[model samples]
Target: MSKLEAGIVDGASAGYGAVACTEATKNPVAVANALLEQGPHVMLVGRFADEANKNFGFEVVTNDHFTTPYRKAYWDQTAAALGQRDSGSEMGTVGAIVLDEHGNLAAGASTGGPTGKVDGRIGDTAVLGAGLSADSKLAVLCSGAGDQIFKHLVAANVAKYHVTGSSIRDAARKALQSISATGASCAMAVIDAEGNAAIESTAKLFSVSWAPASGPSTTGLLPTSFPILPTHTIHQCLRNRITVDRALWGGALCSCHGRRRCLSILPLHGLSKEWHPVTSKEKEFHEEYPGYISSNDGPMMAAEKLDGISSRIRAVSGLTAPFNNRFNGPDEDSKLFARIIRGELGQWRIWEDDHHVAFLTPFANTPGFTVLVPRKHLPSDIFAIKGEEFSALMESAHSVGNLLRQALGTSRCGMIFEGFEIDHAHVKLIPIHRHSEATGTTVTVAPFNHHYQGSVTSLNGPLLKGTASLTLDAAELRKKIPVKTITSPRSWADPPRHLSAVLQEPWYKSLFTIQDALFHDSIAFFQKQLGYKYRAAVIQAVAGTTAHLKSLLELHRSSGGKFPRVTVDDALKLVVMNSNDWRYVVESDTSKGRTLTRDGELKLIQHFGGAVWVTEMDHLSVPFYQAFIDDTQAKARCGDLLLGNGEVLGAGERHVEVKDMLAALEQHQVPAQGYPWYTEIREHKPLLTTGWGMGIERFVAWVFQHNDIRNMTIIPRMKGISFAP
Candidate 1:
């Protein structure tokens, strides 16, 4: 027998084989088996082995069948480059070990001698212990650098270590280490009588698969760590179809039912999915925000609401899992405001102070959109600030605006205050670029058409149809109005002028008598139509005043007169100067004051010539959170930025002191019991905070010079409108 068939054996028989010459025999293993069965010798080789194969009736064939195209190319290239062919060019040796039901073990290895080798050269594959070894206790098969393997007796060493009480893994490692020390590479698979097995290699094993008798089968490259050996007997099978528990290992059978079914046993890192190493850039990001994992495995911090478009900001901890925005309560543990105050949710934070934080909104309505939220869960009303809090809030607003302008290369920023949706006070900032490509060179200053002719007949037509004029003196009407006792001349409030001082002017007296007479008649008209009471008279007065001013400015512009020429700004100043008389009657037992209904307000807005700022409304006319103009608690310390579409932004100071809050609560008729936490903040740790909110859609509409606010929202959420996914 040749060395290729030197040490191979079966459960009840022994065999070995090798290709002896260029045109040798087929079935090398069969020839080796014939030699073992027919002779007293343990092996045979060269011409003698071929003659024995023919004499024993084994089939022989031409050498071309064993010479693959790849081996032939390697032989040619090696001969051309090194002046001689190399034996290493021929690879893909075959080997196998089998255990039968009787507990007998056997192994075999076979390969043609390396291409271009010496005519009589014999390799390790035909040796007893170098390329193949088998006995009752263990079996081993090795491939690679046959001469070196023969010199080191690699397979024999593995069997030696295994028989000497070393584990299959330890024996494999020892054998591999010995081969590596000799400057050679080799790989081997060893199995012991107990069914334990291991494969150790100095080169990649390429592929490995296993199926235990009781679990799913798996296939993949071996992990860098320990191999996960099968717990039950496994036999090599054809066609790569590993069987587990008597069923085919495919589809559902391959899933990890109760145990890990992966080919390699790797660390899982407490995640449901496979662990992946973090990239270098992600590591840097983690270094910048320490304690925050870049992966999706940590405390639940933020989530998208069911609406899909809107998202909820959440606390890093203290919240229940699977957060839902629709189910969240105002004072719930998940409130983002609470965590911001505690400094736990610091990721993505841009700017912050003792009372508030400014961050880039994850659900930005536009580029550079940001949210400035108070750290405390104060009531959703912007008017609830008082004292220095008012000034600080304004300062914060200014700072945010400047930041957006400088960072976003925008000329201005838009602000708004409407907290009807979220019961948290958050101010929205939208960067306003003057030269937006969407609107081009056309800038929309106001959203209404200014086409009314500046004629008394045109302006008076609507006013005359609504009511009959009153004959009361303007001076008498002015005395009946309540004069605020505590007042300060601020930029947002009228310059500390008494109501009487305003009524003393000739122009104010004329406008006051006409506006008052028209307001009463309009009230009568609205009461008769709706059969209910509302402040529709105030709506009519504001609307009429707006029309009248626009007409006067239009007429002046058309006249082309130099002396006493009237401009739109001059007309607006006239309206602001006469604001002292912008009042409506409040009947006894009704609310302290009233403003126009939403629909009525919208109607009045259509008449405005341009943007206008109104301030110092009646204290009871607004929410109790608005700070009082003074200790008298008569007027709210708030201002509204009204556009042709209605109030787009609102700024206000909040009540910081307990007494002031209690007094304002009583004046506005809101019960203190309903706001226990809000009351406690004022009682224990009052903060002087002020801020403003702006509607993102309205701001974008204003910036882009669009008349329709709906166009501004990419996914518009209008009242009474439903959208399908």
Candidate 2:
């Protein structure tokens, strides 16, 4: 998790390019190279340079050439010259996206709000729901006052508009307008795979005006307060955040007790099912199966005779017991035991004791149905069960499960069993649904039940249909109390390292890679589309092309050092200028008036034309922009980069052209490690778009939306020691 100080930046202000196709693609080196290839009129934004490098460890996307201060200075001077003066207290924001050689696009953003600021002052750059948007092929983001952005639900709206056939610009305008109408001061942009773009702002002449030092300020016009924009919405932002969090964190099952609790016992009878066992009277005369012999003293033995008539159940079904264990004595609750065993007075489906064994009648609701030895505490394990016991257990379980569907009208039945808890073995008769009812499970008992601490509570049961006696069916009893998923200390030490086999598959890798790429691309594109233009000049003295270089030098001299000197510097400027492609804008803490933009430099230059076009002619020493461009385009194509425009560009001549242009722009750009991970197999890919946004404080500050990871887990378990309960 990257931890950058918080603040805000507004797109409604002058610095950003505002809107363009693949606008957020900021690969600095690539962007600079691309700019050299294009005419000088093009500008780029080296957005999020400081924060990205410090926090994310590496650039996911966007150029990393310019610092926040540099970008802010450029915007500040531009605003000043245009008659808009700077207020020192506003936050700095930069949003960027970069495309890798394989066409994967990465997006990210950063911001610093009003200097002496209040906490929780979120800006467009920091808040994902409004700040950034990414998916395979394109990326989009915004920069402006968060309050205003939220009014429009900008990020989500932009995405929606893009999907509905609007160009990046169109969607941005629509989103911005929606919020503007709501009185939110905002600016927005969008970019797509095919180079289509859109940008729109609700207000002009917007400038950062500090809020009162001690109290709040009322909403005002742009340059002061970005009252509202089209795309920001509280509900939408929340929903999107929740969805992201859920995806980031998989099932919350805890390994504390080392058991999965797919189905938890809820205190609701309607949510449970009960079963019964077959009886002698229920079986036909010819369907007899050998039974266990119970002597007058209660000693039990298996019958040796294989009567042609078949045991009580053998004729009708090839069922047998799954396990057998002999105990000399029974618990003091023999009356309760007898009732359960005889299937006469107990409500449970299966029960056993020294005196007898009986199973309650089966029901339509029960599946994988079978009566098994429920309470035989012994050292022997399942391995001891063989031949008839195994066959009977399996056959009965299968038959019962099938019959249950016939009885309950469900398609399948779920079977589960665990010999770890009770001294005895028991088979679970569960009815499976089209979808498993068990969201997850946790095992709380462990290490000889050492963690055991008892909780006493009164039980709840149903009144008999016509009688006053309370009848607690096992299923009902299970539901009457909340069953905790226990975690065993031993299971917590170290889960089996993620199975390498499962991770090695293409599907698994694709899930992460494509998602990441899509996210970066989407965000970068959005920011670029939303940024404003600037006059970028390269202060270079190319050997052979001194005349051409002289012209750039002249332009720079005229701009009063506003232009960059080195190719790298030029690249950085372009990105800073175009950073908003996939970034957001929000107000600084000093006041609601400030909004920010952020992203990569190289990607910026590619999206927005820069001063020079990298010719196959430029010196090799000069970083090539076309290569970066090509890579970015490839990333987009492979869904590694977001398509801000929300439309797919299939491969062919047009795509080829875009690819070439990108390659040219990317030439000479520095490549980073792990860049190839974003690549994917072209033939088999899921129809998905992905991007990542995180809560810096949540991860860094150790405070989560749900308080902590522990709160979100089934059962908290740490290393080595086994906890038993």
Candidate 3:
């Protein structure tokens, strides 16, 4: 590519002797080398120089070239300052796709590439046809787990769906379903020929903003924020050269064309087929070709078999007679609704009480399939539930059903209480998006009848979408409270020589600084400006990013002038026992927020720890962003880094108390204010301000692919070992 650039430059300088299309197309590489004279070899200095300028506010770094021969101090110095930003020297980095009005469609992805990706590895972002695609009929860009997105070519398929008559919203949703089905979170932006636009994500991290075509040009608007101009989109600014240069560049159009401006989750098609397992009778009759399973089995036999399977399968998670020895005995069966108070199972619990616990079941026949189980070990018979008990259960069921619809982007919910499954009295609440789905589970726990089908994704089910952390009623899965008596001994020791030498390379050592800057920059984008801000600023988001970064860097230098690295297995050991611990969950502290849900948590992890985009709500308007770490590598790496060695430096409790006390001190401010001074001052007046401290280190690790976040931190601080304080 660099050679091509140099050739273009040399040609411009040489003369205007243009080659015909046939000659250029047949021998492009030959033409660049020339017919005889020694060909000019071109070496590229890589894009880090320009990337540094764009991200770190550096100067003299953008679009600059220098004589390269390992001797040019000026160029060498510039290049030295920039290393592999994130995702190493690999196959695919990151990309931003946006339509430009420079009369051409230029796709630019502003978000950073997945941090610790493999060398020679590329994801959808690197593939134009996969992550981004455009034509005369439509254009689309997608974000999420790139591998899944690439396989489905979400961007291209979205365009196809749009041109084939699907509405803009429908097209985007349908395209995303392919990736979401794989339990991978993804977001997409789409625009059709009519200029109608839509954006959707299976997960909640999607942000769509646009300025009117004739309105403010997207000149300086932050990419993560709103797009000020139709053309100056964040993606356009960071457009991928390969994508642009490889395919012909052409003029681009606006998604929300014309002078209108709008940014919202577009209404989806009001239709979803009620998916269900094959009826027991049908399954038995057709189990094997025409003969089926035990061809002569009586109709009653099918029901009996299905019921037995449900009873066993539903109880498969934590039965007393467990295999791995995790469970002392079998827990309650699915149908036995009364045994729902199994908090130890670590399932996604929404609401629970002494009589009943409402939770999203892993046995989800449909997305967001929830069940209300009674605490008592009662029989599956509804008659077993006394009037008062029934009333109470029904009341909660009604409420949960309603919340599921409201919070999950569905209009109706189907309630079922079939005795065929586990003899337990459990009530199922399935969000009903279409008339057919009203039947709830048509088949009796068939395997194929699963939630998050690798089909088009939708929140039409209680398939809780956004609000990765926000639940219906500040509800969280009630975890088995940790043993208060347990004591952790913090200890520390120097790492192996190889690990200690990890950051010796200058470029490698800079990983910490670069990612820290990225995080701080994100903070600035959220804080209340001298002008507008959010409606509600979270009280705990008081940690200033600048201060935090400075302190963290100081610690990193002190530790080893770099972060440490650890094997995945070794990293997991730090928190394996506490994997179920709430602190590990990617979310704001549960005590602070009202709406808390773990649907996203379970969805992402249940399948090797990948996330299905939060399919439902817009959490920003409610609580702050609730991060859900679904990837295994990202999750385990975080545990190791967070522990430092055997434990974190500050006690979580004291830290919270200090923050709260600080907030209290605000009242003392001369006629002072509370923690979020903006709320008191009405900074972003009228807008509900929401705030939360994003785990910058975790994000950095994720993007930078830091093996041991310790690589970026100070010396290992263990619980038992004292540091050189």
Model 3 / residue 427 / CA error / Å: 18
TM-score of each: 0.32, 0.22, 0.24
- Over 461-491, each residue of candidate 3 has an lDDT whose tens digit, in order, gives 2322233232221222112222121111111
Candidate models: Cα lDDT each: 0.50, 0.34, 0.38
Off by over 4 Å in 3: 1-106, 214-389, 392-725
State the lDDT of candidate 1 residue by residue for 1-725, as single tens digits.
Answer: 11233346553443443333324666677766665566645576666776777888988666576667875676778879878756554444566665555666677777765556665666677677888877777878887667778877888888876766667777777666545533344667777666778876653232444565466966554311211112111221212222212111211223313332312111212222332222111111111112111111122223332112122212221223322213122445465655544444643444555566666555443444557776556555566666576567667777876776765566766565433334567666655645534332111121122231110010001111100111122224334544322111111122234344344543233334444443455753443333222332332232221233334333333344211222222333453333342334265634455444444334334434444456777777677888888876877888766654556778789988988988888866789899988789878887787878776556433333345544333333546543323
Task: Give the TM-score ranking, best first.
Answer: 1, 3, 2
Global local distance difference test of model 3: 0.38
Model 2 misplaced stretches (Cα beyond 4 Å) = 1-369, 372-399, 407-414, 431-566, 569-725
Best by lDDT: 1
- Candidate 1 versus the native: TM-score? 0.32
Model 1 lDDT, residue 303, Cα: 35
Candidate 2 per-residue lDDT over residues 495-546, each given as its tens digit: 3522342245332232333334434556534434432111111111101111
